[model samples]
Target: MDGSSPAAAAVIERVLAFLDSKTVAACKTVNRTWYTLATIQSARNIDCHILQLSLRIAHYKRKGLLKSARSLTVDVSFVDGYLSPAAYERRVRDAAAMLQSSLMPVSHLKLHASSAHAALTDGEIHHGTTAIGLLTRALPSLASLDLSDCPAPLLTASRGECVASLGRLCRLKWLSLGSNDMSSATALRRMVRANVRTLVKLDGRGDVTDPTMQLLMDAPQLRQLDASGSGISDDCLLALVRKRGASLRELILSDCVRLTRHSIAQLTPKLLPQLASLDLYNVPVTTDAYQSLFNAQTHWPYLRDLKLKAAIHHASSRQESRATDDILESIGRNCPRLVSLRLFGCYGSTDSGLSAVLGNLGYLRELVVMHHPVDPLIDEEHSSSEAGGSQSGSSNTPTAAAPAANGPSSSLSSDADVWAGIPSLPSNGLPQHSSSARRAVLPLPSTAPSSPRPADAASGASSRQRIFTSGALRNGVRSQRFNLLNLDMTYDSECAAHLAKLSHLHTLCGRMITRHAKSLIEAQFPKCRMMVWNID
Candidate 1:
């Protein structure tokens, strides 16, 4: 029962360890020492969901328990189980008051709120203005602020006075205002111009326009930018490329359908040199565009990841033959360092193109080629070759050829010989090392069973059935293999698994993977130290 006894010290140590394991709520029940440690840890990553938690955190500050805390997160979302809007607002104000008066200010603050429901509300104008006001006045020392899913009403209200308040945040380093409808790009430009010196990462997805982009391009410290779904044109992207080439690391123009090949060509030299990752998903880029991107000796030398979704077209006619081949060859040769490549829904790519990639990109770890025509080489034809080429007098051979027109038929002939080359891995049993080395090949889901067939097959009909079933088998096998790890069939699971396996993976799209997959990945890869998953 002695206060200084060894037993008392051991008990205190056990209680501290238990508190460390539990979250803020559970830790609160422990004694004073445990409470102190919990407060410190909780304040490191504050969840501004429950109003009472914020209130209690404020109380701790007043009592000087959280003097050593450095970071605070304020999330105002109903999904996170935050209080009702009115009550949440009051709590925010209370916390802001504490922050404003605290002896030690939080160095970093994150704000996440979904105003989609508010945007659709009847009295949105009032609600939006009030919410913006509360946020603008809160967390004065915030170094990073993420305003994703902010309501359109809030973004457009009062001529962007709220956003202009964002300019007043002199210490802000990162700002992400994705998925909001900012009606006036001019106001956003003003805000960007005002805060250009301190801002580093700018993500104005779907809301940014040319004028706002111009302002961001002029920003001094801006390094990472994501304007995906922002309706950004080639000209706007070019301006950014020309101005911010040296400092930039990542640029995502996904779903900007207006991005043409010519625009990409113009921006390539200026943007590709220092870029680590580029996303051109759903754009109208052609082979020439890719050629231009890698044409420069220094172009994307540091590039590690590239996403090309639905960018190319099939060589249906004679004119497209050279273009398609040129594009495929350029990707194979120039992007050897690419570790992660996603060619989702690209129609022009064939087995030749894929073979070029696999042969060159030896260090690839994650490759996604979903929705493209499945290569007979990787599907039924592969197994057929393994069983030995077609037997003599097999009925599979066509007896009569179609009458020729002007030249060789443009359609891909089934009789055309598939590539039989198999590249060897290095002595380490890994692909050659490259800065860009993640490879993923997601073909159209196989219709065949997952199991491999015997050496001999009886009929052509059986082979066709197996080919059709290949997609189903591939999906089923991958899902089953990773199911115990909680991985899904989507691109996210592939990405998460890749990261878990390759410890060096960065700039992953968390949306492609599920939360379950991420957890499993963390459990699997204890050595993976730095990872930032952008779920939204």
Candidate 2:
């Protein structure tokens, strides 16, 4: 058989595919071609736990083949005594020696260890010293270095020397240090200052303060920043936004509680234009402030994902009502490209506010309004009735609605079932009526028992008092609580019925009986693709 023929080439390809599944040693003896292909595939990506890699290093050294590795990942987790102080030092030194001697041209080096590792503790200076020495010597050509979940306190405590060592990683473009115990912001500042020019991503959770953020802003090359669960305040966020980092594409500020309307007003207009995604979890921003930010128009045109988490705060009086209204209105008119919106705890937003915002964003694909006050009122009422009926004599009846020291409702239930029986109105049925467009007026289930007499009411006047005062039984009453409560129940049933008519909606998630209502809708409108109920 001629070796250069097409048939021979096809045979070689088939043999190579089979060899890909076998181990290097098994493939080596198959043929010279198999040996070359197996070795190349094996050298392309090397991932080893610290212990395994240490053992492998010793074996490779013994075999005089350590220099063949091109990519290496060392994960030093606290498993099977491998992360003990002595073992950690030994592994680090061995890995470093191997890298220095044979892997100097390594392009990708990932150093991942759990926070519990002994060598990652500030108190154990010897372990940190050895680990830092190893990292400094082993990672010269690293294009990606992820020191994620390494004990930050230990790294910070060894600040001066560790920072100097980290500076030696001149080619590092991606870095993540999320969820560490780095108490001193100064250490992080030093690290960023030393390597900002080459760094493209920084995950400095719990250690990024305003000053450190300022230093990062100076790094013109930074494109992605994850400050989630960090102690960063609005001041730090403002500083970050104000600084022109043209390369930035994603910014995650989840759980940064100090962000307020004032900070959002200052930052949104500046950062929105450059950012492709922004996560503002539990950040307090008034409607007017959001409107002002959206008014800039230039900011959100390029935004693909804008998450406004818990966008509302409890207002003290009616004076702030207009501000909240303006915010919802602005969001609806602006942000047309939003794909995901999670308003999990924004109590100030009602169905009207949500409709205002969501109605305009035709591109929304993933929406999570769980636990927020934005659920249909009918759904909320059905939930309350079910809960109240279940625990009329027990203390748990109102447990779901109890407010904190500050007055805010606890959860929002879906009222989709309330509209279960309503006739299918045309899509354009409520073009003039904003609420009517999505409105469903389902018939109340015959199964719903009549409203039970207030258990505590003893007389006619007392019964009226009991009915009104029942709002207090559940939680602190809003000014229009009773009226809202009744409407919530009514609307919930109505909406559930109407939802059955929407044949185009693929998925719908809501509360208790809403699921039943969704099934009924699916039965009526078989074209409706998916229905999920009782989803919070």
Candidate 3:
């Protein structure tokens, strides 16, 4: 349909709304009317640093595209292409000049360092400050600014012009300076106090201490605060929450290790009534903290997304495992509106405990359950002892109980607990098992050699070498799917069959799905995509 006609234009608008940016860009070439509409929409969000930003801006300006641009991302990391620090600074200055010359009424500007860029050194930090000053001076209407992962120090700008530009940014309601070295709270306090009344979202995930937090005491309009890894304790956190609690909607305190049970227990629903998303990953909390935060009496009805993944391979593994159990149970009792739950290193949690929480949160769309490290992997001496112990008990290890590969029953678990339902093959083409005792000989990694270095021997006999499995995938979301059924490390034929029964499932990611299990999964769910990686 051509965009010239009113009815056809309305239909095309609706269709364009549903399509992604690339599709919309492609649709622009269909006709003149479409071209005009697409150009306007495309210029709304511009990635100025994706290619030669100066050339792109010049081309867009020639085509009258720069005027429509509203949200611009000025990535300064590309300056790394230059060999010397002088070359990098010159390029940054040139970029700033080009941006200054452009007339793109950009309201949202994100000056970020690319992920590949290393942490900013003192020299680079100075250059970064100059670049920020240049860009902010050019964009007078800037309302939202994200300097996240930028190498600049938190408190002081390298140049006075940079600090003056920040103070002049009165329209900035959203400011994100995550990962900056804010060693001087004095400098941060001055800048924040200038725009404290209008700032809504403040992300200070840097070297923020109690002094840094105290700067936020007057920011009553703040709605979202991410002070992750800021090295702040309960006293500072509680103080910030007390001042900004009524308006704060999202709080991310990930990796704040100094926060103990005494401080965490005080995080009642009353403190953050409007809180919607809470992330406490790697924050060590005791059982009492979990109980107090998510008890029957405590309730955060608006809370939807919660991530409490523990920092595995730590000294407090046992305590953290127990804390996980208590937290999961409390989630079942309190957080009824929970949409996503991630529990890493929850080794002590049983199938029953997980099932209980799942049953309660029916609207849950994402569940990440990475159980604690296997018993053998965590302790070197224990692994060595187990290796020796297994050799001694090789005769007693149930080798005979392992079913024959040729037998049809061998492919299917005899136990009912292995599968949820069905006596034989279900419509989904999966066999249901009733028992948990189904046995299989796992292909474990070989043990380390007896002779090892002194360091290796002291750490553990097994520390000399790491066990390499045939297949294992690195952690992270590998792909996007319409229906995400289950993502876990429990890879086996029985678990594959059980997962196959999930009728709505479209994607399954695991460390290792054996060839047999992969084939079974394919047979049961023809449309389902399986991503398996070998374990290390």
State the lDDT of candidate 2 residue by residue for 336-388, as single tens digits: 66665544433344445555654566665555443321222223454477457
Which of 1 and 3 is ahead in lDDT? 3
Alpha-carbon RMSD to native, per candidate: 12.7, 12.5, 11.9
TM-score of 2: 0.62
lDDT of 3: 0.61
Off by over 4 Å in 2: 1-45, 54-71, 77-91, 104-108, 114-125, 159-163, 233-236, 296-299, 310-329, 348-362, 370-508, 513-516, 520-536
Between candidates 2 and 3, which one is better according to lDDT?
3
Residue by residue across 1-536, what tens digits does model 1's lDDT show?
A: 22256677566544544454355557656666556555555555555543444575666667676666565555544333345657655665675566566645566655555554543443444444454555556656667766665555555566423655665677677777775665645545655776788888888777688778877776878888888887777787877778887788888888787778768766563554678888877666655665666452534456677776443333433222122434654665676567666654433444345445545555566654433222222233544663465556444543111112222432343110111001011012223323221111221123223434323322221232111211211212211111111111233344444435443432222112346656766676544332221221
Please list the C-alpha lDDT of all candidates, in the order they appear: 0.51, 0.51, 0.61
Best by TM-score: 3
Better of 1 and 3 by TM-score: 3
Cα lDDT tens digits, model 3, 67-155, are: 88878886655455455877666666676678778867888988776555545555656665666677788887677888765655522
Q: Which ten residues in a row have the lowest lDDT in candidate 3?
A: 417-426
TM-score per model over all chains: 0.59, 0.62, 0.69
| TM-score, predicted candidate 1 vs. hidden true structure | 0.59
